[model samples]
Target: MSFPKYPEYKDSGVEWLGEVPAHWGVKQLKYLVTCLDGQRIPLNGVERYSKQGSVPYWGANKIMDYVDEAIFDEELVLLGEDGAPFFDVGKPVAFHSSGPVWPNNHIHVLRPGDSAWVKSIVYGLNATNYIDFVEGSTRDKLTQSRMMSIPLAWPPHDERNHIDSFLDHETARIDALVEEQQRLIELLKEKRQAVISHAVTKGLDPDVPMKDSGVEWLGEVPAHWNVVKFKYLIAEFEQGWSPQCDGDQAETLDEWGVLKVGCVNYGVFDPTENKRLPDNLEPRPELSIRKDDLLISRANTRDLVGSAAHVPMDYPKLMASDKIFVVRLHQRICRSRYAVVYLFGKGVRHQIELQATGASSSMLNIGQGAIRELWIPLPPDSEQDRIVHELEKREADFAALEQETVRHMRILNERRSALISAAVTGKIDVRGWQADQQSRQSEILMAAETRATYG
Candidate 1:
């Protein structure tokens, strides 16, 4: 997996460039490419919507939409002028696009002097450290002058082609592996949701007698189970107060903080998603969060409205916001964990979405009355405990698998970035590199065997 270093090296005079192969030449980026920023035209959302068509409308980082007109029709590289992930080394700052496309003013367009060098230039720009060149307080901006003055190391024409070919082949392989891991993570999420939905709606006993619950969505529950409105199990519920707070989160437990709606957006409590209360405002001790407190987001996007989470522990300094509701369940009739599982089920989620209302799609609110009217199937207290324990075990297993897959993806992405930096900077020589035919054949055979076994 390790590459060979250059046989001879020479200082490039530039610190970031460091050293290059003895035979390589170094020059500023302006001399190697022509800036085509003047050709870019900016389009607003409404204008683009009216002119929707086949051509891509590019923003700083990605395609924002498709428009009816084309601006440039040649091979070129587009670099983010602002709003790009310049500090994230694993992300790309520049990308190559061909054929007809319309780029917005937020991107800087460049046409390489040599058509063959388009891809190589993209890799080189992406690998460079932009910390010293970018500016701006809110968003990093790569000015045209700073971009043009970037130092670059280049090899002979034929060697540049070889480097491009080597990188294209190797990066594609790493990307494929990353994609497989991503797909596995998504599948695990689907499986986890399915397991929760089935367990909460139907008892673990498959042969249990079934009876109509009168409610269409409740369907047929176990003969002994009772289908009742959510209000029956809720002993009490209260909305919190919102005070103007600092933009940053409370750094220490001693500092008072107000929870944001996003604290339970994913159905898990995130204590860190809070804003610090200003010194001028008095803390409300009565609204302080307590252990096992059930919190639900009262206002959020439609999909996240009515999202709920059970506070695992107490945070005396943290209080719920006006957009959140704190609910206390009747412990004798329902277990907190069991109620959470039922609320997260697909059937209950559908009801929440249907009842939510707002002026805009981005912000929706669910009223307390709507939440109380939602139906839930109730089981014996002992049966509720059993279901929660089984679900906890399954969730642990799924979490471990997902964490491992995500870690593997991180490693692959880091390897890819390192390889590109080494090759483009002449730290490694790739002029003699070629795709390994035998290794590729072995991979194909292994993939086929896996499909056969799984199918």
Candidate 2:
């Protein structure tokens, strides 16, 4: 395919050059964009409007979806004005004022001003990474002042359009590749989880005699296994400490006294993402997590409500969330590792659902009372340990695979961002670019192969 060509450069009065076209101008964002025109509604007024008006309301959470109504009906970009994933900008963020709700205080609406070209303005804002300007020690928040103060590199109107169209096409291609990688990661995760769940719940020997374990989700276990409730093997189950308005947490610790949610997986107490609390702190008697304890999440989104993790010998003193259940196993009754794997398996999770009750607003919980009554299948100690050890090895392999996938994902993300930044800054010339023209095709192919094989 033939590519478009631009006129030769004649030192068109610009300073930054290597690949920048000579005619482009460097300008401030304030000159090109204007805040949406309207009387900013009060917070309570906006809420009432959402209830009573006929417009679509736009907020940070609603960026990916459309609402019933908006305050206005123009093509505009909405930016986050507050907490949680704070100061993020929504790109391709056009919203037609065709619904019942309007933009809220948590969103700042921006429109291209007379001096600005809309497409270029959006791309410029995007290339500038204005979202990073939102400031806060916590997640980060954006103020209107910060929103209007970002810098922009400007080109002549016609040049701006050319740059915008070029960027739109190129960036879309990169985004498509990134999206493909994300989908692959998801599939890998599902497959990995399936492998782990199967090996842990059922022994490696497919020839073992099977029988119904009484629980429907559990399907069948070895004929010699006994079906019993998890509560029967535990000494006790209960909540940890209650942090009132004042709790003695002044600094974060690593060597560990208490295990926060980050340390232990709330439901199954998987220590994969564990963080340590300072050893100087006093350990709460009830909350102290011991080796072989099964921790379950009491509260979370409905799907993750009963997700669990097994605490291993290496890390024992972890305390989980008030939302987690810690099951202490009786040595003579069941093997802790096997019990942990069993509780985290599909069947036990299905059983926990029966005990869970609550409104649509939030899922109610199942605590020690409900946990103690849960029936589980008990296998002989030797068989159980053997099954657990095999499952552990498989789990380790899965974890390693997951980590490698994440590393590739991070690298791809960085490269994708860098590609956009470089191209937009005019660090490389692509004026005669063709879809088949690739400067680093070999490196990209190598990365793709590695990702496909090990990712």
Q: Give the alpha carbon lDDT tens digit for every residue of 22-76 in model 1.
A: 9999878899899999988998756776788899889999987788889999999
Question: Model 1, clash count?
Answer: 0
- Report the lDDT tens digits of candidate 2 across residue range 287-400: 667666766667654566666666666443445557666667787778766766665665566676777765421345666666777777776788777777776777677678
Segments of candidate 2 deviating more than 4 angstroms: 1-20, 36-74, 82-107, 114-119, 129-134, 244-259, 266-283, 313-320, 350-370, 373-375, 434-455
What are the root-mean-square deviations of the candidates from the true structure over C-alphas?
A: 6.3, 6.8
Error of 1 at 45 (Å): 8.7
Error of 2 at 330 (Å): 1.6
Error of 2 at 159 (Å): 3.1
Model 2 scores what on Cα lDDT?
0.56
lDDT of 2 at 342: 66
User: How far in Å is the alpha carbon of 356 misplaced in model 2?
Assistant: 4.6
- The clash tally of candidate 2 reads 37
> What's the lDDT for all of these models?
0.84, 0.56
The candidate maximizing lDDT is 1
